[model samples]
Target: MKDDDTRIKFDSEEELIDYYCSKPHPKAFTPSIVIVMLLCSLVGGIIGMELIVKFGLSTNSSIIGALIAVIVGMLPMKFARKFRNIHTQNLVETAISCATFGAGNVLMVCVSIIWVFNKPEMCTGILIGGVIAFVVDITMMYWLFDTPLMGADEAWPIGIATAETILAAAEMGKKAKLLIGGIAGGIIGTWLGLPMDIIGVCGLGNIFALTAFCIGLIMNGYWPTWFGYSLGDYYVPQGVMVGAGMVGLIQAIILIVRKYKGRSKTETPKEELKTADSTFIEPEESELTVEQENELLGEKDEKTGHIYTRTTKQMTQTFVRGIILYIIGAVIMALIGGIAAEMSEGMLVVWVIYAMAAALISEILVGISAMHSGYFPAMATVIIFLVFGIFIGFPPHALAFLAGYTACTGPAFADMGYDLKAGWILRGRGRHVKFELEGRRQQYYAELFGAAVAVVLVFIFYRSYFLAGRIPPVASVYKATIDAGVNGTVLRQILLFAIVGAVLQLISGLKRQIGILFAAGLLITNPIAGVAGLIFLTFRYFIEKKFGDEGRKNLNVVSAGLIAGAALFSFCTNTFKLVSTNSKKG
Candidate 1:
């Protein structure tokens, strides 16, 4: 950790304080970074739309954005020197990462639902609603980050990969060569149609959870051939996800409650806990300053003197605020989509309330899976909520609105976690509290800008894609599920599977999240990915066994390299395809 390039070193306490207090941090929203961010956003948007439409998945573009920043910094120009700052590079990566998810997972999915249902007239309402949901989702993540729940220490594999990629590129040593080699291998493997990203995750993610995920994938992919029953056809995956998601949410609440409830005993004095400022209450005779009080209230890293900025209380309030905001956004979408006109007042109320709840739950489920394994089942989670909406007997148009609005929440939420995790690492793991917070705020602004860009890109280009009959694979599934509706047999299957999923999640507890990862795998039904990931995991285990912690550290760099390489290849090839296809159409 001491040799890690992401850390800041100073000669003495005076130097450290001067570095934190006096240095002018790189501005995220400056004109130069903004220009680079916009360019990266365009590239990210194109890659996202192409990959999602063609293959039904979107890779994190953080590495691509960071690589672009690094490339720009290497140019021989006076102005280019400023781009060398790691903070500036982090902001650029944050922007493109948001744009990628915002375009593909949020806006495009929403628009496609309306188009698939031949309700193009409602596309405007869905887009606006999606945009609003996206903003609120990112805002909530911003507030929730660094809390006890989704702390900076969470795996957040994609973020770690991006951060390592930047660090390696800047340092340019043996680690850099390893990263470059891994990237090249990733590119070559992906070109051969391999799941390089899954392999990358296999090396970095929780082994137990990923093993469960691989088992689920194998079961989902093979059971149809061996037993002649499609898990998806029986709604088995959906049921499992529903059960696991419910338990996962409860587990989160329990953790939050237990943390706060036991705070008086473990954290603060009983008298301090009762004060207006809660844990910040200091002794009268001590006369400690506010900084000292804050340090007392938060967790301090002994080596770096870094105290966490977000409190448990603040996280809870932000979560509640997010719920309220989602409710408002749902109501706005329902009104704008004209769903209110077709439903009874009671049913309309139910629809709005359910949409809000569904969005929040979906985001949590997706966020947890992403934090653990970097695999977010956004579409499947949306479908799970859509199934519930069907049971509630909403009309087809309302279902479309509900599904689209629900889809908008999770991807951006999870992607925001990745960006912040990267920023947290680059900012020296929050060692300098004020500087870290400032960098985080800048990342948020950059995310907002990128999301706004994605909204515009989707708004402008979705019609062309729809006209060309290029819709996401999930859109058709959404329509089919809505049209077929649900039956008693389906309900029974879902309930049975739900129980199994719940038990698995409960047994796994929160940290491992085996159940969530298993559900994510089952939802996809890609046996090849499972097999490939298992192979990579085996390799990683051996490497660690032979070399110990050093091997693990080296593997982290290589895994990051693999992800970056695959992403770069995907971007270049996909961008070319998009351009050529659109040109031919024109």
Candidate 2:
């Protein structure tokens, strides 16, 4: 086995354990690390807000964050040495990532909905509600991650891309050159108006899912020309998401229930030993001494086939708690946003229930799509719920609150999953249970701190942007939809396609994620990207078939470089454009 700078090539499980036990991992949240995290958070938060408000998009900034940590580690100062630890870099990446979504996705989007609705007075209330929803969003994913429903084994292509970037930078060999070359290619490709990120994801994600997604994208682009009508004319994408999302949620519940039932039937008696004294079974290939091997032998967890730091039951409870919190937040938003004044008693009750359900359901749909293909249609998902709200006769003011609250959920949830997946890889893929859990907890804390910073920044600066009439452009779409109102014809069209969506999801099952990815692609109009994804998927299949896992792994590394380079280029160019525009205004 070849050893990398970031990880050791342990000879055996016993050796891996002994090595980790002897050398305590570096602390993730040292004072020095926090200072770096704060800087990255500020930069990422500002860039994310500017990009979203100016261009209607936000990039994953974790690659940029990891790059900053690497630069800091290279500084000659002794104090900067702490940044060299891969775990510390992971935390830094988490901070910037959390802040980016916290500001652009949650805080700005929420406040913009109210401002765009001409209800600027209610921005404060909506902002508070958004913060609460944001917290619940991250907490829900933190607990539910690694479960069968949102398993760590899923593609999570963005996370994998970020991890590979970090590893390449740290190791700095042939892989690093591949990454650099890929990054250059990505920048050049993107400059030519090609979708480099999609191509990159095609090399790393599920082939079947991406194929479906690319087909949907192609259909979306050419639907009017090919079929003599626009899909959005009848809300086809929204209808598909509605049907697929419901089925997807049901599938998740079924998975959890099945796992619980199977585990219940084969329950095991607890050993009379504590966690510290607990033993583990050794693999046959372990090259440990006879005494060491004997000492490590023990029974595995009969419930789960392997050791996990967190349990399934705990994740389920955490999800329930998150839903309850979202319900309470919805109530608060209704009372504070003056929604209570607009609706009757029965209607108010219905509104609250609908709001909470919309937020959670959108998160599930977005998460599934992102995990499968690194593409989440967050705004489109919210609009689906918005259509439903209009169908239920929600007044414009009430719909504003609904859109604002629900809009904050899905992006934050998906972003958190990406960051966590990156950390999971850096933490030895959960092989060291205690270490992985502790590292994850530290990452969570870093995210909270970053979110806190974003909230403060938005509170201070959001009004300036609104005054300049630079609110997120999506807010206008929501405002327009609320004004247009839903008609009987549109509602009928939605209902008709929903069944088709549900059937597709059911047939695909949870593993393929075809239905959700198809909906994701349909929600965004970009034919060139779809074409790029198809081409790369074909190329990736040929490489894997000819060269095997090693070739596949190398291809994934180059793909990561492509994604990172494209994202970095986008951020820099956008930031420059924003600054230049702001300076002229000043």
Report the Cα lDDT for candidate 1.
Answer: 0.82
TM-score of 2: 0.90
Model 1 scores a TM of: 0.89
C-alpha TM-score for every candidate: 0.89, 0.90
Model 1 stretches astray by more than 4 angstroms:
1-22, 268-296, 299-308, 583-586
Candidate 1 lDDT score at position 341: 90
Best by lDDT: 1
lDDT of 1 by residue, 262-282 (tens): 765435432443453332323
The lDDT of each candidate is 0.82, 0.81
- Count: clashes, candidate 1: 0
- Candidate 2, residues 1-586: lDDT per residue as tens digits? 3454433444533343345433555565678988999999999999889988999888789888988998898787888876766677888888999899889977898899989877788888888888899888888888867766676656788898888777776666677788999899889988888899999989888899999899889989989998899999888988887888888888978966875787644333234222423432223435445532322232234434433334556657877897799999999988887878889999999999999999888888888898888889989988889988998988888998999999989887888888888877776665544555566778888888889888999999999999988989999998998898888999989988888788888999987888888888889999888988998999999999999998997898889888887888888888889899989989
